[model samples]
Structures are given as C-alpha cells and as structure tokens.
Target: MSTPPRLTFVNRQGERHARKLSLFGLRALIEEMQCQGVTARAVLSGTGVLSKDFDDDASLITRDQRLAIYRNAQRLAKRSDVALLAGARQRISDFGIYGYALASSRTLGDALDLSFRHLRQAGPVLQITSRVEDGVIKLRSHDPESLGDLLPFVAEFWRSSNLTFLSRVLERPFPSLRMLLPYPAPPHWRAYGRTFNCPIEFEAEAMEWHFAESIWQLPLPNANPAAAKVCQRFCEQVLSEQPQGSELTDSIRAALVNRPGRFARIDDIAAHLGMSLRTLNRRLASEGLSYQSIIDDVRKTLAVEYLERTTLSVEHICERVGFSDPSNFRKAFKKWTGRSPSDFRDADLR
Candidate 1:
C-alpha cells in the first residue's frame, strides 16, 4: 500500500483550528470504519468535513477540504476542548510522539528548538520565534493574517500560554512581557491586564515578547541525554513511515529562531530551505497549513503548560508566551478553555 501524507492540526480559539489530512491514514481510518459498518463519511460530514478526499495525496487535497475535515471533527466532538484531542488521537495515535521528544530535551529552550524543528510533523497553526532583541530574548510570532479580527484574542492567548510554560520551566517569574498587535483596544482588556499586571502595548505589527537573554542559554533542567535518545528513537520510529522528503519545517523553524539575526524574512526562510517562495507555499499547502500556523500551535502548548504548572504572576507569563500585553492573554485564554487563566490556576490548585 502506498504511504499517505502526514497529518497536522492548528488549534484555533472559538472555532476549531485547522487540520491537514494524511491520505493513507485518513483512508485507513475511513475504510476501517466502513468495514465495521459505521458511516464514517456521514460522521465526518456531520463534522462539516467531506470524507471523499481521504484518498487524495496530502499534497493533493484542497484547503477547503482540509478545513472541512477540521470543522466536521470539531462539530462531531462537540466540545472545542476535544477537537485537538480527537484529532491528535486519530492522526497522531500517541500524543507522546511529539511530547516524547520534548521530554528528552536538555532544557525547555532546547525542547522548544526541537518543537519548531518538527512542528508541521505534529500539527498546529502557530509559529514560535525566540530571539534576542537588544539584550533580551523574545519569543514571538511572525504572522498577523492568521489571527484575523480575532488577533487580540489570539495574541492574548499566546501571552498566557507562553508565559505559563516559561514559569514552570524556569521556576521564576519573568521581568515583563511586551505584546505586539495591529489594533487599538478591546473591552475585555481589564480582565487580562489585572491578571497579568504587565504593561500592554498596542498597535504593533507583530506579536513579540521580551525576556532576560540569560534564559536562552540556560540549560534545560530536564535535559537528559538518555531521555532525549529515547524520545528521538520514538519520533524516528513513528516518523519513519513518513516519506523521506526534504523536511521544510526544519528550515522554517530555524528561520523563526534566527530572526533579528540572519533570517528575518519569509523569503529568506524559503531560500534557506532550498525551495522557491512559491514552492514553499505550495508544500505547506499540501500539509493543509501555513508556516505561521505551526508556530502559533507551539506557542500555545508551551503557554498552557506554563500557566498550569507555575506560580509566577500572569503578566510575566504573558511576556514569556509572546504576548506584548497581559490583557490579550486573558481574552485568548478564556476563549481557549472557556475559563480565565486565574480561574484555571485557582481551580487546578484547589
């Protein structure tokens, strides 16, 4: 049997994020359900996805088709919380596939580096860029279009998510967070601002963050060579089934990291990845994603982990997660979990 393209997903707030179908896996999932007499197509269609394209190559499916699958899956799953979970369960099998690699890293920063390296291989529509601006290292996003009118919502979530994780990883509160947005203001600002206690910048071009540069070089407290080897082995095993093509995500992740350095342009990322800008776009299209989507997903996962595990102030967490403002993080967090970060932390702690 021919191998299918890999599957990926982007976690969107309010609406289901996005999904990229793997022709082989999708077909298998559908076929298995069909044999069992389950109307897989009907179920998927109920989720707003058409199941016909399961046979298409990952590179062959249209954006609308992939989006439909995501929408349908979210609808079928009912709770937005379960969309990523269900999607991961079907396409990824073991959540440990990517988490395993992270567990193996020498530090949170290293783990983040590896995440960017293989983001598309997992799924998600957020890009993470960790760089040093002035003397501070900032973790931020490169795309604005993806956030849409919900840019504030997305940016706030990014803030909450990244900072929450950083506190857990560093065991200390960051000095401050700086958010970058293109708009003026929103009504729910106070909820986010009070929670974070950090200055919120507005009308900026991109979602940027600032942290002490020292953290970038800090070794991951959990960096274990044995663990990393184990995780790497697991990733290789699962990813082995994937066709051996020049990995585009690796180059894209690198560009995101090296930003404010040598690679600050998407064209530069494309050039470094050894494909034309158009080809890069086309290849990402095949996966049913844009480079920026994966970046945001990485940021969200990390941000949430921070929020849950650490006791650092919310504003500090916001900066770490790439939000220039604390209020934005609050709105985004509420959208993601239907609960504010403070409420989440308080409930979980209690």
Candidate 2:
C-alpha cells in the first residue's frame, strides 16, 4: 500500500489553528447531547460556537474550538458512552462531499488512502496513521497530550465513528480483529464488544485497530471513478485554500526560529510584533494558544523536520533546536510525538 501524502501545513500547530474544520463533528456531539436531555445551548456554552452555525454548510471552526465543545460534552453529558453513541450515529451523509469521495473510490484501499490524504478536510481531532505489518493492517491514532482528561472520550469517538464509516462503505459489518486502547476500559465496556464484535485490550500503549490484509482489497459497493475524481478535486481545492495560521502566530513562529538558541521571551516577541505584552497574551489566548505553546510547537516542528530531512545526529539536532541537554531533548521529543528521534526517523525512512 502507498503511504498517504504528508500535510502541506508546516506543523501540527499550524493545522490545529487553521480555521478549516467543518462543524459536522461538533454537530454530532450536540445531537448526542440532545438525545441525553442536554440542551444544545448548554453543550455549546463557552465554546464560542453558535447553534445557527450548524445550519450553514460552509461554516468552519478551529480545532481548539472543537476541543472546547468536546470539553463541554464531557462535563454535561450524563452517560459515559456519549462519544460512542454519537460516533455510532454518524452516517456517510454526515461527512458531505468528503464521504462521497470515499464512497466513490474503486476499492477499500483507495478510499483509506484518500481519507488519510484529505483527513484535515474532515476536521479530525486526532492524528491518524495506517500501516501494513505482518500481513495485518494497523490503524492507529496519536493522542495529543493536550487532550488531557478528555482523552478517553475522544479516543472512543474516533474508534467507533471510523468503524461505522468503514462498515457503511463496505455495505457490511467491519471484520475487526481486535482493538487496543491506551485508556482503561469504561463502565460501558460491554458496549465495545457488542459494537466491534472483537477482543478489546485496554490500558495498552496505543490506540489501534487491527484487520486482515484482505479487507484492503475489497471493492467498495458504490465505486464510481468519475465521481471520485470530481469529489477528490473539490477536497484538494478546499485544503489548498485554508489559511495556514493567524498572521500573529506566524510572526511569532518566525521570530522564534530566527533567534535559534537564544529564544525570545514573550515580552520580546510582543515588542517584535508591535504589540504590548498584555495585547500579545490576550491575542494568543483568543486563539487558544500561549507564548510557551508556540515555543514548544516551533521546537517540535524544527526537530521533526531535521529528523526527517537531514542526517544530523540526535545530539547535534538537539543543540540546533535550542536544547542544551540531549537526554532532556529526547524526552521532550517523545512527549511531543510519541516516538524517539531515532524511531521517528526510522519510520519516516520506511
């Protein structure tokens, strides 16, 4: 199988702050909350999202705002299976044109490849990856440590919703081999067995779903090459038009990179951007970011680029990225991407 293309956005931070996500996922969460007797207003409170936004197909939300809605769902929903139920309720139509592109693909593998390449268009909350190993296809989700207490809920929604989409595309039940989750089993763990119809391993090191290689070759029921091409073109057009990041954030990142080892303080960055410290803080807070977060994001982006595009040694890369201690850099890199520098490079080379 071919690897999906890397995102055009420079880094994770750019992608998250980009205002390109549709309200489909948030709408699903709101509907699920409504089913549980929670009002839409209650679920959207403090999210800076409005109910009328759902009616507009072109309305977009930032990933930060989407997370805010998820946080609210976690707080207001009565049942532990809110994510699962919400995800299960999703149909292909809920995805709009993105769904049509996948459905029109000639084979399941083609659809999976397209989905990964255009994943951001769907407004995903997690970084998903796929690989074929030992005659089995492994689909995994990378947890953003920022999710914090909402990890379990988000993980469940991602897993369940994906299974639902795959099943619908194939016009049959998904033959999942097993599931491995990082978090402990929920109180409604039995629902997982009923939903996936497979073994569930909780408290594992990662979130992954396993399937036999044959599934990849299965022909999609609604394959239409002409339609697939048109829908895919539309997806590409939308992705190309997204704003990479806010002007202020981009300026902050450039300032951080230009300084190299001597990282600028918040006050320095504020002055460089022609704003007071208070204004800088407030602006970043408005975008769900902080000075420290931007610094961390720039460091991670530079480190990953070096690892993937250069032959620099770990120690040398660490020094170049402003880390004085190689050991400390290793820990921070793993925390940022869930992989050591060497391991990340090896995977990239593969």
Candidate 3:
C-alpha cells in the first residue's frame, strides 16, 4: 500500500496581520449566546463587529476581532457547554466553497490533504498538525502559550466543529479512536463524550485525536472530480488573494504598532530591520510594497480599529495613527474607506 503524506498546518500568531475569517463561526457563536439570553451586542463588544455585518455574505473579521468575541463568549456564557454547542451547530454550508471542495473530493484522504493546504480559508484559531503512522492517524493541536487561560474554550470549539465537519463529509459519525486534551474536564464534560462518541482523556501531555487508518480511503458519496477541481482552483485563488506577511514586513509592522503616535522614518525602520535604507527599499519593491505604503496601510487599519472598537474622538485617533493634522487624517480616512471617521463610527454603532 502507498504511504499517505504527512501533513502539518500552522497558523502562527506572529504574522503582521491577523488571518481574515468568514462570519460563519462568529454567527454560530452568536446564535448559541442568544439561546442563553446573551444579546448579540453583548457578544460583539470590543470586536468592532456589528450585527449588520453578519447579513453580508462577503463580510470578514480579523483573527484578533474573533478572539475578542471568543473572550466575550467565555465571560458572558451562562452554560459550560457553550463552545461545544456552538461548534456542533456548524454545517457544511458554513464553510462555503471550502466545504464544497471537501465534499466533492474522491476520498476522505483527498479531502484531508486539500483542507490542510487551504486551512487559512477555514479560519482555524489554533496551530494544528497531523501525521499517519503504522495503522493510525494522529492529529495534534499545538496550543499557543499566548492563549493562556482561553486555551480550553478555543480547543473545544475547534475540535467539536471539525468533528462535525468530518461527520457531514463521511455521511456518518466520525469514529475517533481516542481524544486527549491538555486541560481539565469542564463541568459539561459529558457533552464531549456525546459529541465525539469516543474515549476522552483530559489533562493529557498534549492535545491529540487518534483515528484508524482504514477510514482514510473511504470514498466520498459526492465524489466528482470535475467539480472538485474547479472548487479547489477557486480556493487556491482566494487563499492567494489573502494578505500574507513576509518576515521583514511583520517586523516592521510590529515596530510601527508598538510605537503608536509616531510613524517611524524609512531609515529608522531599515536600521531596526538590520538593513540599509536602500536595501530595505529594494527588498520592499521586490515584494511589490513601499515603506510609505506599509505606513499608510497600518495607519488605515489602526484608524478603523479605533473607530469601531473604541469611543475615541477623531482628533485623538488622528494622533494615535501618527497624523499631526486632523483634517489630513480625515481626508486619508475617507480615501481609505470612503467615509469620515465619525461617519464610520456612527454607522458601526447602528
């Protein structure tokens, strides 16, 4: 028998910009919170997300924004099973074209491989890796130490939602052999057993899911090579269009963000990055970006974040984004988003 490929998916937290995610997962969480009598406004607090944003199919949120919501859910949820219940509600339709690509694959193995390659399109919060050994497949989640206290909730949500997706893809309950989690069992731990239908072990050395290798070759009922090819192509295009960060750009943005209210000169950034100003310019040009462009992008992102997530005045925001003149900041903000800062904030409130 041919050996299955080893797959590792990493969504590290060090990227310059957070990964953009569809509102599907957020919508599911919001629905679950609503069931617990938690208002959507309460759930979306400090995330710069609005109820109206959910109505737009093309709306996307940054990873940080989503994390803000997750934190809110953790604090406001009245039930311990909120993450599990929210995750369980995920339908294949929630994944959009990514789901279609998985559903049309020839085999479960093909879908796994495709999903691993394009996981960014799926908006995972944790760094996950998988491997096949002997007669079993092991999937592991590498928890980011930065997640600290929020690890359990995020881990539960990720696992449950993924299992739900797998069940729909296989047209049967995904028979996980064993599940190991790094945290202590929650009060509603029984829901884990009911959802996974597998032996659960908490407070383990690592987070892992074990599966029998035979299931890898299971033929998908909706296998359509032509459709899969088209969907995969579209997924690839969407992934490519996503904003990706280079190491230098990430460092530069980190520096810029750390020192708000002052925009670093190109020479300063170049020196900080351990390169000459000319070299920095050349490298940025190679990546189709300019130093001023990055500054503008960063300013625009921060400006919008403040406008939506805070009640800061326009002048205060202008200073925070390194603009000395409020009028220039207003013009730049309008140019970037086609709305003045006040107008944008007011619209978000509605």
Candidate 4:
C-alpha cells in the first residue's frame, strides 16, 4: 500500500504539535477495550483506523481518531470515566524500554528525571515538567500544542496514567496527590474522588500535582543505579533515532506550505512554540542545520516540483514560493539547480 503524506497540527495556542499517534499506541488503546469484552465495531467506528493498522508499527492515526476511539470505549463501558480507567489500565511495560528504565532507576526522582528527558518518545505532544519548591514536589503536565477541544480528555488521560505509573514506581499506593485540573469539572467529576484519592481542584489554569518532598527518597524495588544508567542510554538512543531537526524543519515547511505567498518569521514560529529563538537555534545547531536553511530547502524543493509538474508562469511560481522579485527567483533557481526556472521546466518538457 502507498503511504499517506504526513501532516502537522498547529493548535489554537499557535503551537505546532503532532496530531498523530503511533500505531503501537493506538493498538493498545483498542486492545484496552477489547480486553474488556467490548466489540470491535463500536470502538473502531469513527476512529478511521483499520484492523490491519493495529499490527503495523509504522502507521499512525490522527488525534481526532484517537479521541473518538476513547469516547467509543467510554460508551461501551457505560461510564464517563473511560479515560480515567483506561489511563490507569496502562502498565509500565506498555512503554517498552522507556518503562524498563524507570523500573531500574534508584529513586523515584531519577525515574522522574528520566521521564522528563524522554517522555516525548511515548507522547510527543505532552510535556511533563518536574520541580521542587518550598518543601513540595510539583509535577506539571502541559500541552500548549493541543487544540482547546481536547484539553480535558488529553489532560485526564495523562494524569491518570501518570498517577498509575507513580504508584507502581513507589511500590505503594502513592502518597496523597493534590491536583489542579485546567478545565471545568465534568459530569463524572466524582469519579476523580473514587479513582484518585486526593484533594482535587478543577477549572484551574494548569494541571499541577503536588506531593510531599518525602516521596523523593522512596526507593524503587528494582533500583540499580548502574543498570538504570545503561537503560537510560538505550532509551536516549531510541529517541535520537529520529534525525535531529526533523520536526523543526518540517514545521517550517508546513507553515510555508500553508501560507504560500508569505514568508514565515522564525521568531514568530519559535515564540508560538514557547521557545526562545536562541534555544531553537541551539537545537538546530546540533542537527547541523538552521531555520533559514530549512526554509530555503523547502522552497527549492517545491520550486522544482512546480516547474517539472505544472505550467505555471515563472512570475507566478516566484510569487508562490514567497519571492517578491522575479529576478531574485531566477537567481535562486539557477543557484539551486544550475539552470533558470524556465530552462528547467523546458528541459523537463523535452
């Protein structure tokens, strides 16, 4: 089968994040329902994922599709707490080596640190930050990149799953967790009491979980600092398998494609992503690339595509590629391909 083109989702927050889930993650979501004896039809309806998709590790599903499947599971389970239950249902092993590294850490703090560094491997859009202040340990989950519509569902899923993971890490029912949820309380808000035995506050500006600093020293049952280090290295290797700057450059390309005639400001894209231009530049430096280089690459690639496949005028092509001057476009086109745009298009016509 032919592969579909990948897509980028820029949320209302003006932050660009992925709207897709790895097939492995989607498969587990589906299996969570099937294991509960729910029929496949209801779970799969509106999910846009086929049976074969679950078995294909390389395939992906959009955020809408994932949420629909979860909602369907909620309906099938006849409860408003589907996200709560399902999130907790996930085991550490579900994350593969990422979970293994957590289990091997010497302390909960180490495991949490590991999570902060590589959590994106499991959920790219979710950002988990950990800190200690005023004798309270705080862990915050934020998704500035998620659309407003999914704020509640996504936050609930991450929090519940995190609570489950923490309980396992500490090898006990985790200490009382004080919570602040970003959205309004739901009809099933009471489920929070039953599922999370803690003080809860809803409609807050952020999702914050506070715990006594004493929880930091709790030893993991499988604590082996040396093994944890080895595992951490492997976990990082897994994450680094992606070509660095891939996402950054791809986002630049997407912004350009979406706004054809206008050049996107690197500063604006960086700011919307809650990143400073310096940090972005440092990250791209590690990839041996820069923002303007990526923009130029995308423009040149698109220019070639337009020239070879279409009969658009050179002037129009120049405008479409964001060049205000036809002469500038001619200079760039020649510099990129060793020929003028017209010559390149005419050569292809032969």
TM-score of 2: 0.68
Residue 243, candidate 3: alpha-carbon lDDT: 73
lDDT of 1: 0.50
Expressed as tens digits, the lDDT of each residue in 139-256 for candidate 4 is 6654322334455666666667767777777777778668988778999998888777899998876667888776667679988888788878887776666323365655555555
Q: Among these predicted structures, which one has the highest TM-score?
A: 2
Indicate the TM-score of model 1. Answer: 0.44
In terms of lDDT, model 3 sits at: 0.79
Query: Clashes in model 2: which pairs?
Result: none
Error of 4 at 164 (Å): 1.0
| Model 4: lowest-lDDT 10 consecutive positions | 1-10
TM-score of each model, in listed order: 0.44, 0.68, 0.67, 0.59
Put down candidate 3 lDDT per residue, 228-266, tens digits, no spaces. 999999888877777767757755765666555688899
Sort order, lDDT high to low: 3, 2, 4, 1
Model 1: how far is 277 from its true place, Å? Answer: 15
The C-alpha local distance difference test score for the whole of candidate 4 amounts to: 0.66
Global local distance difference test of model 2: 0.78
Query: Candidate 3: TM-score?
Result: 0.67
Q: Backbone clash tally for model 4?
A: 0
Q: Which lDDT value does model 3 have at 234?
A: 87
Output the lDDT of residue 94, model 1. Answer: 26
